[model samples]
Target: MRVRPMLLKAGGVFVLLVLASCTLSGCWDRIEVNDLATITAVGIDQYSDNLIELSLQIYTPPQGSSISMQGGGSKGSSSQNQSTVISATGINFADAVSKVQEKVPRLLFWGQNEVFVFSHSAAKQDIAGHMDYILRVPQIRGSALVFVSRTKAKDVLALTPQLRSSSADVLEEVSNLKIGLAMSAGNFNIMLSSSKGTAIMPSIEIMPAPEGQPQKRYPAITGCAVFKDSKLAGYIDDNITRGVMWFRNEIDMATATIVTEDQGGIISARLNRGRTRLKPRISNGIWEMTVGIDTREILVQNTSNTDVAELKGTRIVEEGLKQEIEKRMNRTLQIVQKKFEADVFGFAEAFHRKYPKIWNKEKGNWEEIFPHVQVKYDIKTVIVNPGKRTVPTNRMEGEKG
Candidate 1:
């Protein structure tokens, strides 16, 4: 009887404790969706010497909308003007963000944020410090795309995306396609970590839309920002950017146009697979690096005399292609080494990896050494297809024209 009574009391106390814990846990970390001020993109512009302009695209929740949040497009905006974009000035990024929120009624939430565009004025300034702000911030997504806008950063964000709700999605897919060099906070992290203290970022320009189009258009990559020791060194053209891509072994979907003396027309080849190997050697106490690239090609466009039946002609075409590719790669190397004086190719990293002892002795003089580093290229290309033409379309001189 005594044991039964004690068991009953213990059971009642346990049940009460369990119910209380459940109630507490359920209520914890709960925030209403209505309270979140969703920021789609953050744009920074140089306002003055002492202050910077910040713009935020914020979504306004509808009061009586019945559409579900899971739907592809947001029904949160009640009308054309319901969604809002606002701007404010502050000396620092955090301050600017806080000021922008003062006018916004809801709490600023960046979990859905997708991009940060630095104005040309802002980017022209020492942006290592500015980029640092984004790196250290906890609320921002690292995957968010980073762009250097040719025009004001705010204008890029204001271009209304017709199909998508935000420009972020468009840029995200563009970066993935390797349309040019990938420039994002995540990629910046890798760039910042390079031992050579150089980084390259893709430059995006805004162009006028077609006559009938209301919105402005963002064109393909045309420029690259060069960085030396975390400061803006200068910018390079698209050709140099392609060279950089080749050296970095990150070339994707690049078509090379090669002209052969024997071939009547230009033969274009698209690289399917390519690998760049950096080999370092010490010759007579001097360090040298060789960049070997192995590429497999598929014939894309042939506008010349393509002889499919003539195996000898195909061989000649392949040799010509190999020479052309090698020439382009070597030319790119010269610009990077002799002109740019930028070790964007990781020659230093290659040396450090191969000859650590030599690197220790020569690390101090890398700047002076890079320009003189004996770098050579060996490119191997295999042409797998001849396109539609197998036999000679334009016959040899012996054959009838």
Candidate 2:
């Protein structure tokens, strides 16, 4: 009888332990997705001397339906509006965010934000200061793409995109294409924090509406903002930005069109591959840098009489490609290295890697020496494919006629 009583007490204790496990596993503080306002994009602009304005593009679902919080939806749909923009002003980014939260009825959630745009004025004022607030917010993504807007960042956010769900969606896709300089907030911060203290950000501008389509204006990556000492030094236009990309070894796709002076016609070549190397040398206490470019291009369109099958004709096209690349790079160097005097090309880092001791002594005066650094280009371009036709179609057609 005593043994039977002990067994019954142990069984009751086992049941009690199972009940406690269920209670511990319950999600008591879980936030419902329906109650959170998902932020898809954010913009920061200077409101006044001490005030900063924050704009958020929030994703709003259809009125009656509750969708999963996975941020999946058709973009640029003609049927329903998917998002809304809200703005608030405060002393700093954090304070402005708090003000924005007050205006929003639902809790502002930044987990889905994909793009961050800063107005040119705001960038020039103090981007590094603003960047601190951005990184400190644990909810925001460090991988979010960043851009500089020529006008108010909020205006860029407000533009109605015809092909995308929102302006942020449009920006995210374009920046990924790498046609212009694409930088994530994390990499941007690293660049600013580097010893060289130089960085570059893609610049966006509102393009004119297409003919008879006044409501279809959209933002475009038209140039780049060059920063020196954590401040906006100047900008490089689209053409010059391509050269910058080449020097940075970031060029993935490009088209080179050159006028064949001897043939009196035009030839356009598509770059299949491009590589750049920076060789820094110190001879007799003189710093000289050589930019070596190795590229393979395919002839896409040729109105010239140059024959791709013939060795002599191929050399002509190759020579033209080399000169064209040199021209673009020289123009870029003229503006960025000489005019802006901004070391956006990582020359300081390159020198440091090659000559550490000398760099330690010379880095303090790098800004003064950067403009005077001698640069030479050793470019070699080869025509990998001349397309299906060995000779110009136009020339062949004329010859037959």
Candidate 3:
């Protein structure tokens, strides 16, 4: 009995030592930072009918004690030109990536990449196919911003940014401002998988250089690319993109400028906040959607002679603003809804939420029903502030003490 107890204790001690040793062993596949070629952005283009080209913008760290200060720095400043572009062509996204890896001496790392630019031709070919590899790859982040370039994406990546560290940095800043349509990789996938299978991505193009200043060029977001059935349908200009933002409830910062009828002067108002609601109803088997917009704006500039201090004058200005907004929205609807037949405004999702069983039975017919769906708008705008000046500068003489 004594021998048996001693033997059991020895076995338990051996097992405990083995478990402790396993815990002390760190990751077996750890990669060193020095061996990594960290990518900041990725650009995709169609090289040929069946070949795909992939470009990577990799970050280059500043060489020994050469950090450039913003106020004054040498032409060889580290902050100015820190990224380099490398490209390779392959049969598909994965194959292209492998080719790029073979060319690069260091191991390609993707954790820092936050921007993906697709050329118009590549996007038209089938963006969803590219997105499939992106979604499955564990290294690529889901929140990466996606953009469609008016020109070749590789060219866009090659252009150096004047303000930011790299082209990717500039694109990320633009997306953060919400100046136009900004779609994330995951959100785009969700949109494509939605009931109607429609999506939109911001469009970027190189800004035209001024005469005699060919070097002053940069990528700018000018519009949006519409996608239907996982293919590029068409594009919408900036003005129409704003209207789309209103319909999608994605408006963050907006300026509505209108020419007042009373004074024939322009007045610009900045949106303080805005909300949109979509109400779906079925009447006699007819699908109808009512869009309600409630917004508050502050007058930023009043070049009109109208006395906005008075109640009557304020109402008139508000009416003009309302009309301006409606005009843009109507134009957008005409092109996106009636012409392109794209349900990018989430109308299908709204209807499905409202009527689940009916949606399930009729989801397949959403594309047919979308273009003809009756849409009514209820827009209400409140002028929260008329700025520090109650009366316009031109109408100061007409003000009473």
Candidate 4:
């Protein structure tokens, strides 16, 4: 009996020891929230003497009573005091980033970065060289939104807007709306590695804030920056950018206005849904592409006397919309092919998909042949809804016919 009691006590002590050891083990790589300085945006610019300038928009934690119980304060107020911009210059991107890190008090964190902007000048140089560090850094996300600024990229990061907390917030919001082609770092990398090595990224420009606004400037998606051979080739305006978007089948939402001679006014329609099909054909040693667009739209505004509710009038309006779309497509195609001579539309890929053997033979001289590649447009538009009033409110009541 004595031996049995002693054995039970020894077993209990061993169990207690094991439990204590397990409880004592804690997180080994724990990092305190206060020790990190989160970066919301990054900007790259070209400096003199072949140097690179790196700018970071670091999020600043609220102090004292500035922070609210619900977390961040009002959107406008929070962003006004929420972030600070710091810059450093070096011979390369990584070097500049390292130098900037030295000045920051806390550990610089990029996991939450929302926007990355490159200046027009910086884009003209070797973008691939500067982009290598961004791709190699495991801490940075591959889906971070990217842009090219018409002015200094740092200026874009510094802009304060009335609607959003920060410029980064504005850029991200606009990109989500699909106002322009949204390109992420990961997708851009794929484009760079593709056979054509052509890419298009949204371009932003600073504009004056809305009247009576406190902020001096705001950022807007103005156009697109075209890249060839992984370097900035040129820029296309907003209209041309929309055309490119149509060719790439990326048009999610847009508005088009057409003037009707018979109606004696303009008719505006909002694109509800759209799709594009590219057909590549080789005939008689000539390569040609046909772009087919099928779209459904809603008649939003009608200044003309045409009764869009009637089948005959609706057909006329539909025909007018188709002609307008075709005109825009042809204008865009002409500029991109004759002027830029760049294949941002992925025509090469279309050809490769249908005629791989021919593509391989012409791949070397795609640049020379792309300009000559004939393009055709087939657009079909249908108006799904006419607004509450078929005719404009401004129209005279006597002109009901």
TM-score, cand. 3 vs. native: 0.90
Instruction: Give the Cα RMSD of candidate 1.
Output: 4.1
- What local distance difference test score does each model get? 0.74, 0.88, 0.88, 0.88
Which tens-of-lDDT digit does each residue in 1-401 have in candidate 4? 69999999999999999999986777776567789889999999998758989999998876654456466555554445578999999899999989999999888898999789999989888688766888899998889989999999998988877677788999999999997889898888787778455888899999977888656588889989988888899999999999999999999989999999877999999999999999999998898999999999999998887888888889999999999999888899888888888888889889999999988988898888899999987788999889787667886778765
For model 3, name the residue pairs that clash: none
Better of 1 and 3 by TM-score: 3
TM-score of 1: 0.84
Stretches off by above 4 angstroms in model 2 are 1-29, 65-78, 397-401
In the range 1-401, model 3's lDDT, one tens digit per residue, is 69998999999999999999997877787778989999999999999999999999998876543344543665665545678899999988999999999999899999989999999989999798899999999989989999999899998898776676777888999889987888899999998886445889999998876567575467999999999878888899998899999999999899999987658789889999999999999888899999899989998998877767777778887888888878888998999999989998989889999999999999888879999888888889889889898866665464662
lDDT of 2 by residue, 224-322 (tens): 999988888878999989999898899988999999988878999999999999999878778888999999999899887778778788899999999
| Candidate 4 error regions (>4 Å) | 1-27, 66-79, 212-214, 394-400
Runs in model 1 deviating more than 4 A are 1-29, 59-84, 162-164, 308-311, 387-401
Candidate 2's TM-score reads 0.92
**Superposed Cα deviation of residue 356, candidate 3 (Å):** 2.1
lDDT tens readout by residue for model 1, 198-283:
77767767666756765635444566777677655667777778777878888877788867656567877788887888888988
For model 3, what is the alpha-carbon lDDT of residue 383? 90
TM per candidate comes to: 0.84, 0.92, 0.90, 0.92
Worst 10 residues of 2 by lDDT: 66-75
